[model samples]
Target: MRRLATALLGLTLALPLQAEWVFADFEAVSGTPQAKLFPHLESAGRGNLAAGGGQLALVWEDNRDGSPQVYAALRDLGRTGFSAPRRLSTGAEAYEPVVLGLGEGRFLAAFEQDGKVVMRVFSAAAQGPLATLDAAASAQPTLAAGKVGLHAVWGRRDGRFLRLVSAPLTVDGLKPHAGAARAVDTSPAQDEQLYASLVATAGGYALAWEDRRAGHTRLLTATSSDGRKWSEPQPLNEIPRSGTARELGLGRGPGVTRVCLAGDGADTVAAVWMDKRDFLSGYDIYAGVSTDGGAGFGANEKAQDVFGAEKPQWHPAVAVTPHGVVAAWDDPRDDSPDIWLAARAGGKDWSDDFTLDGARGTGSQDNPALLWHGGRLHLAWVHRDEQGGQVRYAQARWE
Candidate 1:
């Protein structure tokens, strides 16, 4: 049966090539002047990396000027590294800055100034100053740029409670359209909503965040068509506990909540966060998927260390590429905080959790941010040290 054997070999040769993730060595984006770089925020909605138009853009909270301000840097496609860092915030206390790439060497950033929310637009040659978008004592501002100019959402304090506000941004003269800004969530003042994360889709945008409407922290999402009108917020997970929910397990301290969003600019959208549903003092990574343009999200799935979820995992970040979807977070499974990643392709199950920080014995790493562009995956995180914090970067390739 030599002909039969030959036919089997031919069939094997016709199969497609399988893709794998290949990560490069890590590098510090913030050099060693040692005054705390990109201070790690306990809240979500921070933008650490943005990849588009053959370039990578980074923004973070910097305090090198004696007062906290937003700073940015760019990595050109032809260069081996990033350009010199530059300050983007004019306010003395510009906190929680997030950046978005709008293609063609253009970028947009949003941050909290004093007690107001402001936005700034930048081009290749010049940039504009901060334009006041909303003045409602905001925090944890997030920005997403799509076919529209720019979309922003942040937590605004209304008397004794917090609410979510949205605004459509324009760079022409660095001004927001009057009356274009509105509240995304109009619930009672006691129903606090914070830490908003947004993803730009082909049709519009999808926003997700940690909501506290039911007296406990829960993941919620909403969809918007023009950045002004938004649908009602819906829970992404069913919290089992009636008390505090979706809290992080950092050592033995009180639990904290956070959420992040990622999308493929199409139908696929993902939200990842840390929750203590399995173990009150231990955290596990959870993911919610929305395939119908954020109309609704499926049930939450445990995405980290499916084999065993014994240790602590927090600050989960997600990114989608043509290859598939990947989620990374800081885990203490190896007795120390290290970055671990798991990926899934198509309809297959998630791959096993693999450590990306390799042999981490020195510093504590957290706040991992991920982006995929040009068939490459880019990651950024904070390396906490005795002196302060440093921004770290690494790249992954599909082989």
Candidate 2:
């Protein structure tokens, strides 16, 4: 028998569900709503997308030996698929590309170029660059703009400690003042570690990263309104099973470190990450939710088991949609990492799990990126092959 929760008026109904988890759709994406310019090749780094009016803006990198270019795939949701991939980089090199759709008719894309955060805005037509922003020591760049102007944040790796810094930019690259970048958190042993996942929240934005401090590997979080100033770093999730406070032995990397912050505004933020306790289990996916804004959070709960035995899951990529919080990750239970998905109606406990098509073998399905739009879940990932790989996508519906 399976236990599940119900969805009611944006609250939990506490109902039991069916025994088995089944998927509704398993078909790959049809066509490209837009088209690509250069010879198409699979991605080497991360591929991310944002949702908008009957469309989506996909951003990825081609970090090859020749030229490293940033590309966008726009799906118009008509009789067409994604038309083609468009190259967005103009010069030198662009890495860690992040894009945000600023409602109305504005699009913001930020990336690292020449060791600086370079921001470019378009008129929503994908015509050309309307303005340029040059930020200092910017990497892992993320951008979001509103009536208050454009906001961007990145990791600053200077000196012994790696710090997270953010700055605000003018609509036309002219700020009334040069905002300062505050060190939200620091690396104590001069270890080269950084926090990567960042997104704009309601009142502000929330970021999650893996850090090694206090003699243990822990997940840390920080929030901010202006991106220049941030809240104190707090441990987002934990399970109590320790020997002693003085000599707690935490595992090494590839642990439950990466996270995704998703919710309605910044009010209901969900922190999803991977964890493995010393008790009796494998890797598990866990999440912590903040319903009353970023003030307080709920208890960290297990989301799924990688081995289908209620434990040992790894490599999760998550997204928040109107339907609920959608999480897609690779499951390495049977020596192979297959794409698995879970959904909650409006962030409640999910009814069941869904496996995806086009993900096969024991090599590497890796990160399964998810998007919920058009009343369906759009999932994409790097499907590994002997020669190389291809970016695959699928759409699934929830009842």
Candidate 3:
């Protein structure tokens, strides 16, 4: 693989953790975005990437207008791909779009419109309108920032009370008077499901999900320094009989549950999912950690060495750097979903399987993406063999 990372970054630290699973190095582009893409175009993961300096923004879920829409693309660095995608939103059916880089240039994405879950703080560079926030029937919505402003939470189907509230909006979306919607998880039981994931480190925003009261289907968490003051829904998956779950579908992005408050913050947090023994059916790519961040969480660790559960990994796109957590998915073993990668660096060890190839010609690779950039790890997805799928990129740099 081109001598892989210049002799593995000058070789040192003893690295070791490679249990024979090398598939590193990948390239595949065609995520088109100059407009003019219609054939039932499908791009999920509403939007979940930030990475700075070297560049990388890339959001998703743009069904070419028939329904879902929301786009963004930047991928800079040595440059070789992505930078054309730009449609902010048109709306008809937008799913997840949780982003947050608000250091200065500002960012905060958030999604689910039509079904509810909204929030859009704005400023990848800015131009005009933006700063929307919503709440009604809410769906997988999560936004963070505490101490004073911004911080939202969602998943509130009302009537039957499938709880999870929290509020405080206003970067433009308006609706932050302070303290109101707060209901961790009442558990009326039933199918009473939930699928949240929010992270913000320090002392704010730390939510994870997948619940069904107890009948089976676990993994829950909650914490809020501000989003509107929340904290009281714990259940970070302890395994055991491991909730007879199912429905691990992660395809189409916007984050299919891969929260991260990251480490060293005092509660160390990390989460990933797609593990479905049956919550609905087949799924793979499980992970869980929370050294204390959410207070407790640890189990469901099964990246399956590389993939399985019938092979067809989807959704998954995580990032946490210092060289510790980097995930990417969308690998159909070979039927074409290729764009897999796994890294861990120190939380014990991992990294020795990478595959994201395509460009000379592009087609189905679906929405597999990963971003770290503060240390470099960029990889993109959606490369439909050509004239069909578009969106691709590749990058690696960790010494």
Best by lDDT: 1
- lDDT tens digits, residues 244-317, model 3? 43323332121233333333333566666665443333566666666656666655565545333456466675
- Assess each prediction's global lDDT (C-alpha) against the native: 0.72, 0.56, 0.54
Q: Where does candidate 2 stray beyond 4 Å?
A: 1-47, 63-68, 90-93, 104-106, 122-135, 144-150, 170-182, 185-193, 243-255, 278-282, 309-312, 345-352, 360-363
Runs of candidate 3 with Cα error greater than 4 angstroms are 1-65, 69-91, 97-111, 115-229, 232-289, 296-326, 329-340, 345-353, 356-381, 390-399
> Please, what is the TM-score per model?
0.85, 0.75, 0.31
Candidate 3 residue-wise lDDT at 97: 66
Which lDDT tens digits does candidate 2 get at residues 1-399? 122333232244543443322233332232221122122222211226566656666666664325666666666644336645566677777666766665544456666666666656543365455233445454665554433455665667666655566677555422122245656553343443354566566667676766665445677777777666677777776745554232344443324556666555546666677776533455667777776545456677666633354435666666666656767666655466667666655444653445644564545565666555556556676555454544556565554
Per-residue lDDT of candidate 1, residues 1-399 (tens digit):
000000121132222344567667676676663844556533355466776777788887877788988777788755567766678888768777788777777777777778777777775566876677676677877877777657778888888767888877655543333246588876666777889888888779999887766666767789988888888888777656434433443233223368888888888888888777666547888887778878787777778754336677878888988877888888766566777788877674687666454214467777788888777788888787576677777787877
Pairwise TM-score winner, candidates 2 and 3: 2
Candidate 3 or 2, higher lDDT? 2
Model 1 regions more than 4 Å off: 1-18, 33-38, 41-43, 173-179, 241-256, 306-308, 357-359, 385-388
Q: Each candidate: RMSD to true structure?
A: 7.6, 7.0, 18.7
Question: Candidate 1 has which clashing residue pairs, if any?
Answer: none
lDDT, model 2: 0.56
**Backbone Cα, N, C clashes tallied per candidate:** 0, 22, 41
lDDT at residue 218 of model 1 (Cα atoms): 69
